[model samples]
Target chain A: MTSTHDADGDLAVRTAGLTKRFRSGQVAVDGLDLAVPRGAVYGFLGPNGSGKTTTIRMLLGLAHPTAGRAWLLGSPMPDAAARVLPRVGALVEGPAFHPYLSGRANLARLDAGDATADPRTSRRRADAALDRVGLSAAATKPYRQYSLGMKQRLGLAAALLQPRDLLVLDEPTNGLDPQGTREVRHLVRELADGGATVLVSSHLLAEIEQVCTHVGIMSRGRLLLQGERAALTEREAARLAVTTRAGQADAAAEVLRGLGLADVARDGRALPGGAGTARLTAALGPTPPEKVSAALVHAGVDLVGLEVDRPSLEQVFVELTGEGFDVAR
Target chain B: MSRAEVLDGPGAGLPVAAPAPVAFARLLRSELRLVLGRRRNLVLLAGLALVPVVIGTVLLVTRDSALSGQGPAFLAQVTGNGLFLVVAALFLCLPFLLPLCIGIASGDAVAGEASAGTLRYLLVVPVPRTRLLLVKALAALTFAAAAVLAVAVTGLLVGAAFFGVQDVVLLSGSTVPVGEGVVRVAGIVAYVGLSLTGLVAVGLFFSTLTEVPVGAMAATVVVAVVSTVLDSLPQLSAIHPGLLTHHWFDFAEFLRVQVDWGVVGSGLAVQAAWVAVFGSLAWARFTTADVTS
Candidate 1:
């Protein structure tokens, strides 16, 4: 990964050597540095066992660091949390509400203070936030009566009502179905556009790759990689195709040796079509597509058609994770 | 209210002062609303409010023969079997039961959010740990008062109902008439409030210590029970009186023939001492605890 020191007052959060360990001395978040700019949708990505949530908690001062420091909105964490919190909002870990309280009342009850909110105004805010999250119809319904996705929305609504500068959401889509997930993804983009700094952590790399301007990856309590989303996946290579006379296909493979494309295989026998025609596959490392195509034509062995496929983020994930994970099915 | 005001709300150039009393009071009110707004809490309050009426009726029903044997003097005095039962019920049971309930209520106040994952929401918002703990403690204290009053009011009404309102006899053979007895009872109610202050603090302290509701409730109850048991033993009586639970029943002696103001006063002092000691520790621990767990 490429690293450079960038000096800018635009950072919403900055941390150096941040670490946390539980009572058993098991480190949950190791020494790590993170920089998230204001008004940026930062995605914290990692596997299930990674410390994404732990890092977020420490950033909010909900949890103390074992041996490092962090700052939010230009102020030190925990001590400065109070001064900065009024301007920030967040939903972490999971969605929970007082089971007996209506969804709307739950938000209204989360008091900025007890000036005794005008019930009407409080309801309007609660309803508006809920409606924004598509939970308006369930506003009066008790939390226990709602589904998991609805509860998640209720939590998001509570955080949004504060008119804060930042929103920290952890696994906000864990229990969501496809539809709910799409809605939340849209909301994240909309909130960012409206000028809220959003820091979301999730195991869904594809989703993160789609919405985040910046991304950080953690594993085994340590940050493995972080940077602008575009720069992280630059290792994509090109795909190649070849066609040659029947038995001559094997001969054509030897001629392309200098390109470093290996493991060439033919579609059928290495014999020509009618006279001699064969097809093959090659692993090319971001080689020029036109060069590969022209090389085949120059060989005098009949060249058919060639195609190239660029690498995807999924491929990058596998490379980072040591290997592609196996699917249960 | 004006178009200009509406348009300028975000950048109106209004200098924002530090949220002082407004923040604190709003926090306190939020706490009160949470504790008092629940139906179950109200039910508990209703039960306490009707204690006097219940006692009056039970006594009126059984007053014919059993009433003749016990003098109004013994009835007013808290030393007799009936009043002792009342005192035991309020002082012993309430502290154990009510504090447990309050702990149950406030126990989940912070940790529940952690477990539910909403603590992140509150923490991320930067609510001061000290202020958060204070608000929670205030909530528990309000519940504690309600819990204590429930027992005291209920006990007082039963005593008045059964004994037919008369002079209260002190353990020292001193006597105070019904008018004075009422004043003393009010004082006793207040004392009960003070006595449970430590329990409230304990529950709240435990609440911050762990994320489990049952764990907090159990810790608070166990500490109270153990302390009370330790204080009840005659072997430890000398040192026990200094303990908060030791003087929990000191108010009972007030109903005796001669009032022992010295003992009652000592009990109040002990209660206050426990409150300060436990309260300070609670705040300290809560402020330093890591919210991740």
Candidate 2:
């Protein structure tokens, strides 16, 4: 993260050493410095136990941090919360609403709470938002009767009640069917195209990988990486896979180990050469393929085939946090 | 409204979203609807309204029996003129039922939203924590006033039906026309409503301390119960005047021929003190609270 010395109007969300320590002495978010550029689809990626929601809450002034400060839309919070929050829309920790209130009434109620929302246009705008989320049919159904997907759509409608410049959505696609998830992805892109900076948090990389312009990876209460999506994934080296006799797989691993590959390991994947074949996978790092092949042959390990594969963001996450994510479904 | 006009820092020199009065009125109206429109809350108010009807029915049926003059003084007071039933019912409900109704309504003020998980959304709507608290407290207070009037108005109707409305006899032995008597009944309702504001504040403060509405409701009712219990102990007379329920029954002074404004003023003063202390405490706890739920 860049130093927060410059007050960049280009940045929509900025936090400096933002931390949250609960009364029980557990640190939920540790010294997080977030810089989300204007109009970018920023994905905040973290596992379930990570503090993604906590960080989002702190940013939105719903949760107070124990130390440090934050600014939203170029003003300090929560001193500026009354002034700034009206311009930003958010959906955090999934959908919550009055059980007895209908989906339309719920959106209308939320719009009424927005100072910037014109009371005369509130019902119209709420209906429009419901249409936008494809929940118009169930608009009059009581919230308690909504299916999980419908409830999520209402939450999105509430967040879109006013034309906001920034949208902070935490796991917006949660509880969505594949069709609904696709719609959410499409809607996000549509919103991003409309010039609103979208800060979306998710544990699934593939969910955001398609549309995210920038990505911030967080694990165990700390930010591990933050930058343009291309650069983050490009920084990870390609993987080297070697196929050989099952008996020589350990020797090929030893050879790759000798070549300074920290991730050298045997693969459980099926190999081309019938019964006795085996595969070994390792990070290619800076090593040349010829040296790997020569080392394997020099060690009497016959190389049937060798291939170099580009690393996935999942591998990048594993490399950084030493823990795997529940892959995107 | 334009986004740029939605006001930011004071130094922005931009137009605010709307006039302060307009925004506050809108917010307060919305809160009142949310609080009073709920079916459960309507049930609570209806329950209070029925108390007077039940009392009036019992007294009307037993007036011919030896049971007359056997119950509380207000019960006997109802026989002479039905207008006194308003006073009788208000007096009967004050100790437990009135506080319980308000407790259920006001106790759920903040905690209800928290438990429903809507508190975070409201706060982030940028309603300003202090303003949100003000709206919640006002909504609950409105519910409280409604609860008081429910019993009084219903009592008046049942009294008129049972014993027939007539001129009221003051405790000091002066007679007043039925119209004047109703005016005093209104006065009693207003005073009873004022007496409960302190409890409203207490409920709000407790509401902010937890996410469980039932817990807040119980705590609020318990506070009233304990205060009433303590007020009855002669040995604790030193703290009687300062207790929440101390001045509750003092609304009887409103029934006097020449109202003692001093006693009325002191009762209101006690309520004001409680509101001031508890209101500020609620604001303090709520404004700085982290809305994790």
Candidate 3:
């Protein structure tokens, strides 16, 4: 199995012990070696104050890291910023623009900042981006008058002004309506389909769980778990469920413990046999269930059924971080 | 996945930055849109341009009141030579309004963007920090030029309408043609515009020191006010030559029969020195800033 902390392969963003210590003596990011594979919808999952935004800031060359190095699209940061940032689009923290200008004008101004943007095609690019986010209707309205959802969409439009290799969106769904949130999910999936790697940071697990192919969970400025979404849950230690007659519950529990299981419990579940049945469970370690079943049968305990219950992603995260995630929204 | 995926995609080798001029043009246009498009800036400029008109109109109303020579040095001659109104208007505005206006604009350059949360976006646009600073300096300087010209042109039209055009009497009691008078007025406008560069540099340095636009603006105006006050003290006359406002009225030197290039050149040299010193400090602070906003 690949190590979760390894950043050895074709990574769009690779940081080696990236650390940010503010002048206030606060350590915002601590030794974060974040690895985001190319063409991945990598979710940077963390609660508020988990250093997700700080990490993104460091990656984009906005803030200098105290004691580490980072590379974007295979080039060193701030050094290769002029070269690398052109191929990168970012919406860090939130969308910000000249409040007095119309949405279209703000976008044009931002697009013009790109060195590769053609002056003649600037208007066209800005219009196309606004249209893509379904913001064409209000494109001419002053940005300060835009709704929260509209502002977020405008930020997304600015990021889409150019076809970028990597997009680092910090809380892209912030302040969006449910419909707007769904649209953003679709947009992220579409961008990934078009071969763009997206590093989206969010405090909401559901937001990350639905769209991310890879997840890196962080807590208190430290990354606790990182891996592909499905692989992470599959990699967790699943529990085992065992069923037998109520009268034989104690024997089955003893037999499982004797066979080297942990947290052995005989769940008081009444089977169709009317209180004559028992449901036993335990933390399934390396010991195979087949061996346990045979051992139970030889020990004269009635083993009706036995199987491993796959662990959920929530369980895996909670286990690793020892902190609950806002998984609801 | 690798860099090949991004590089081999459609429009992969799109030049990261256009040729130098083309790229600079884009940065310049966007910055112009921002500085000129802002309502607050427009209001500030209109206010700066209003002073000359107000002065011209007041002088026009009181031309027969015997209050002629009671005001500024050139106010007495404004009725005789309309161009002196432009000179007097600049004299009045220079003491406070001009520095205050440029201080607000220049001070807002970095701190405004920082407070608005746009500084991070601009930096991430990969505008090299040095390049962004250069564009900002240019934009503020452009606004300064516009401010001074606004005062001169408005003062000229009002003065011309109030008093018919004629020869300009030099401080040496000699006379020059009206055409020469207009040219000297233009030269004064240019000189006054150049004079504000030092203040712009000071404002920019203050802007780089904080994320609060109001704080930078206030600090910049304070520096200008302090310089003016310090230049006023007779005991501090030793250091007056080094102050930002000391040579601001040197444009008056043009009212002389023979222009003193020595005085004007030294004034410009002081501006250059200020730009070199504070401009470098601004660059250092900005390039090293964390940009958390």
Candidate 4:
């Protein structure tokens, strides 16, 4: 992991030891360290009750973190936010559009420093963004007429009105159905590909797993894990499942001991059953596949089948958080 | 540089170029848009339009001989009655309503966005909280000016159209010509603008304190109502002039023939003082607020 203050393209966002404690003494965010590279779609993933929203607020200078510092687009928190803010666009929390205004007008009002952008230009941008988010037909409709998924899309269009370098979206697909979810996912990918550093925080682990190149899991006011998806998976041990003959179970176990290949355990228990008419699982911690196979053959174990299992990010998350994972809807 | 040269120097462009005409102005402009862009703002404007027509119709239908003693002619009655009624409308009715409007206008000024979740969006734009409050307060001031202007202009035109010209008599027994009365009324209109600053500041302060737009607006109005009631007390005459609620109605006294700058000036001073105090509180609160909905 490259740890540096100044990254590139204005460094997008940086926070060090950021902490926020509510007046009621509940620590919302504690000792958080976040660094988002410019133009990289950084997905912020955490279970509910995590400090995702708090961290987002602190980064935007919306809420003052109790301790530590934050920098956005190279400016310090609350101090340099004005100069840095115009260049960034964001959609935080609920879709709070003026219910009376049309979808297009709502985005028009939110567009910063676009006062000189010809009304026609604004209209075109609003229309295009709305269309991109699959809300083109709903442009003229009142915001109150919009459904939750539609509102989420409208909020996104509002955020994308001006070509901002960074997008801070909180649960962008919160109320979206499968189709709406796909649209947002595609939009996020395209935004990152277009060189905009995207920070999307959500409780949806599956969404983060599918699209995020870099992931940060926050839990209980702390950042539990953050890294490239592949690297975190690589750190875990590889497992192989095998079935054997019952007659040579004990003899195979002795042969495996002679060959020093009997270190594999079943269900985390000591290797009690040998090559019986039973299934056996083995662990290979960062070892080459060829070596494991050779050790099995040399031990004369009746190997019926050998298959390598790749653990999903979901499994790793469940193991790390010590909770039942939510089945992604 | 001499003060004269500084005054005469390139309007806003100076030797060093002053920082963005008024940081508060842009903030104010945005805040104004927040108010004006809403449908409720148009409704408020429409409501103000009816004041002149409604008051005019009532006078036409009633044509009471009793009202003639209150004022001599149509313009006198209209402008005279209009000034007081407008003051009542702006100060009393609006305190209860407009502050709420302003409170609603600005109520969500920060919190609305926070609650709606757009506050973070605005903040991420890196707008300083001070700038945000300044802009929002300024916007409310503009609307305050607009609300007062709406009543003054509409009421005067309707009064003139229906009643014709009438010499205005001040409380001091000095007579002001119809034309001069118009000018003074304009001045009074301007004064109303200044007077409203205190109320707007109060609304702005409440705006900073809460995320609920209605709550902020209602609180300012409640405070205004309570203060107005206290100021109206017969025993508090000595201290009444100091309360902003007392000064908001002082404009009617401007209709007097020999303009009493003493009372007017004091009223203006008191209102300005309230503005400074509330404005400071708003500034401090906004600058230090966490603003997380």
Candidate 5:
């Protein structure tokens, strides 16, 4: 086990064919293999009930896996859960606390339960945590009286109580308002900047797109893709759309076909305001935009406008997972 | 370089190592706080304490009525020896009130956390599932002991206030010194508490079986009630000694002069067996159950 740890200290999380099946015969998670690099704001993105939370539960040892195994920071799980979990902070699903206890008292109780936490300093740490989350004003308030955003912030505070090597936040901004969402995203960015690997799960592509340095997309309990954000975006195919004179559309299509562009197609809709110009779209492979323009100009085809349309991460995600990305999920 | 080393090298601020595994003692302390802190549990305890007050007041007000000779063997002695009020309250409570309270408390132990969504957080502390279950069981038992004492103390105080403390007469038609009588009352209280340990274990087992606290509580009480029902039927005599509540009243032997150790020993053995069996079941269920909430 230490072999993996020694070979890649930068790998904060690694799983080998991890799987979980409920007794009720529901396969919550299929065989999943994942690796999260250290110091990354890694987004665990998947639709609701797509096994994102289930996988997180398995990673934290909250649920037992039917097959395979996982390692957190190089420590094998369930076996090293006690040692590994203490180094990791997770806010799974959502915030949950004793409704009767004040937020401060809740944190105090949780902190006391950690053997590494100094009881004498728990109060100080709790106060600092509340302050960090901008919840200092409501620190003494009972958790039941808190708003949804406040509860989320309190959960964030609990995760930040002790300095951690990894933070697993499952939809930390689920119920937060716009302002609260911004605050949590900013916090995630800061935590990663401070060198802590953060695995933040969310169904919203835009939410993770703004803060995550790396991403893993899942659908139907299986991981579809995992990599740095830039690499994934770079791998997506860019399309070239050319506006040509109505009579020259077929000519341009034939030129692109002759140039080895097999995916070329005519735009279904006429140009804006029913213009006579025809729009032709082609999948741009290794060919450069300049080369396509020169080819059109050389062919004596009337080229009105040419543009390269890059696919957004959402599009790439949908293409890979074969499902609509519902932010609410 | 390791992530920790990078974070510690410059502006990462105060360096902190990974937290250590939580101690069982700490988990237990937290569990106790949760059990005692709930208003529902507190109200239940207050209600248990009220039982002895009502019994004592009713007995005091009707000292000359037919009620004086109408209840348990201890009831006739209540007016003569105030300590019997403690005995009478335990007698009344053991059958239903005591077990009801224990069931509600223990039943809420695990299921309540699950329903409230706190179980996930607690488990992610990676507080070994077994350890969490153990802490919950220990807290339930603590509540059990406290509940029994509450009823006994209230009975003792109310009885002493109305009838005055004095030497207690044995149920066997013998007399004991006042000091000896005090020791016997303490013994009776301890015995009553020990008798409920099986119920606590059973309640904890039910708690592990559901996420709904009310369901667990009702099932636990129903199980105990059904056992009592089985114990009463003469047709079930062969299984009487095996019933969970069959020897619950064995503490009454403490009121006798000779103290029938044979009966008391068997009662304790039966409770021990129940605890061992049900406690194992609870541990098994809790450690393996899928906490989807």
Candidate 6:
């Protein structure tokens, strides 16, 4: 196997031209390139059937890739799966456990299945994990009796049974209520704060925006963009909205255009607040807000107000993928 | 957070400790627990135990004249030789009951996990697919052996109470000591258990072909029923030797004063061949098949 370590070993996950195609000839993941830097809370954002789960599966060695190579923790996957997987904890897609076994017993069995875990300490660790996930009261309940939220918590508890170098959670808060979602979000922040690299996948832009340090947006089995959260949001062009005196709306537009700003639009009528106020919006490309303010003042246009409308992540995501946000895929 | 606290937290600058490698023995133990701990399986076993009791009671209450000429040859001798009860019960169960239970267990080995959405988790444990398949097959075989033993033990206890143990009479017209007769009965029970190895392989192969446990179970039992049906058609004589159920009854040879090694050996060889063919097929399908669930 090839060594996965880069110069500084800063990447927790790396893939070069990774691809997977089902037997029916449907391409699930198409030559995907992904990089998750170490110590970063990377949110893998994608729609349903967008290949997020498939990519995660291949990285974990649960599904064989039809093309390309991937590495986890600086080790080439599958070839090094046995040696590398012990330090990686994952909760993929949804929770799955034996219906007959209690939550504690299920975790104990999963822990015992790990070659690196000491069986003697497994019971205590299982109990600790349950407590960490706030499922201590239901630890003895059979898994079948668990509600959807409880089952999701048990899945999280299983992933926390050991001290892991990385945590890969796919749609972790799926099927969770508002309170449950908040608890999971808080726990994710705590885990990341405690220093484990986490790769969490979700289609919720608001959720990703709140907790992720870096983000990768995927659509139609392809990654559209990946970068630091601040950098990505910074890349979007902020709109300049100018509220001018009633008769000066056309003058403000002409001034904005004369300043070499393209895509400038003048409202047909004055602002609803008063007959003297009119709003003109212009797309600011690389021009500072001070330039627009100075140009309007020099052009003798009465500027009632001027504000820079920075694009939200949701708008940026929609612009990047050419698809609507807010709807669950 | 304090720098000192950050340093003590998980994955913070501290080297991550690798978990202890899972032993093959532990995997086996876990597999056994998973297969045997189900309430459904326990109930199936209880039902199997009841078969012997019902058969023994019927034979014990009936008059000698009423049963002398009825049912299997072993049934006629159940009142005379108590050990025959064990052999008689095995004979009655082998054709369907034993194979049915084995089919249900083996068929659910992989498909059940897939349907429950647990197969993905198991594979991610880094348990090599081939090793997981082997473990599952072994668990199914263990169930088959245990099922046969349950019936045999139940039959022995019930038969010993209904009819006193005595020396055995062979189909060859020779008499053996009681100890030897008990040993022969054990050999027959073991042989019957071995006879189901082919069915276990068949069930496992079907299991790998689908994600629905019920579909796999029905398909596996159907395969056995079809094989038996084909075995009964003398017109298919050319293929009779190849059928899985053709040599199922060859264990009867163990009842003779001098065992027919030729027939017994051939039976075992056929079962082994079936195991090899179907076992390889299961491994091939499982290792290459994508787990979407």
Best by DockQ: 3
Q: Per-residue lDDT for B164-197 in model 1, tens only? A: 4556555566776757767766766677777777
The segments of candidate 1 whose C-alpha lies over 4 angstroms from its true place after superposition are A1-7, A113-123, A238-308, A324-329, B1-18, B46-55, B66-116, B154-178, B253-261
Error of 4 at B289 (Å): 0.6
User: 3 or 4: which has the higher TM-score?
Assistant: 3
lDDT by residue for model 4 (B204-271), tens: 78877887877776777777778878887989888777787777656776666667898789888988
Where is the poorest 10-residue window by lDDT in model 2 chain A?
A1-10
**Which residues of candidate 5, in runs, are more than 4 Å off?**
A1-7, A239-308, A327-329, B1-22, B64-68
Question: lDDT per residue, candidate 2, B82-177, as tens digits?
Answer: 888889898989999999999998889999999999998888887878888998999999999999989988988899888898888888888899
Worst 10 residues of 3 chain B by lDDT: B2-11
lDDT tens readout by residue for model 5, A152-173? 9999999989888899999998
Worst 10 residues of 3 chain A by lDDT: A1-10
Report the lDDT tens digits of candidate 3 across residue range A33-116: 888888899989888888899999989988999988887866677677887788888999999988888999888888777787
| Residue B146, model 2, lDDT | 92
User: lDDT score, residue A274, model 4?
Assistant: 46
Best by TM-score: 3
Q: Write the per-residue lDDT of candidate 1 for residues A78-139, one digit (tens) a residue.
A: 66565556566678777767788898877866644422233346667777899899998888
lDDT of each: 0.69, 0.87, 0.86, 0.68, 0.85, 0.85
> Interface root-mean-square deviation for each candidate?
7.7, 5.3, 5.4, 9.6, 4.9, 5.7
Error of 4 at B86 (Å): 6.6
Scanning candidate 5 chain B in windows of ten residues, the lowest lDDT window is: B9-18
Flag clash pairs in model 5: none
Tell me the TM-score of each prediction against the true structure.
Answer: 0.80, 0.87, 0.89, 0.81, 0.87, 0.88
Candidate 3 RMSD to the real structure:
5.1
- Candidate 3 lDDT at A293 equals 87
Candidates in descending lDDT order: 2, 3, 5, 6, 1, 4
Question: For candidate 6, what is the lDDT?
Answer: 0.85
lDDT of 6 by residue, A24-138 (tens): 8999899888888988899998778888999999999888899988888766887777766777888999999999899998987787567667678889999999999899999
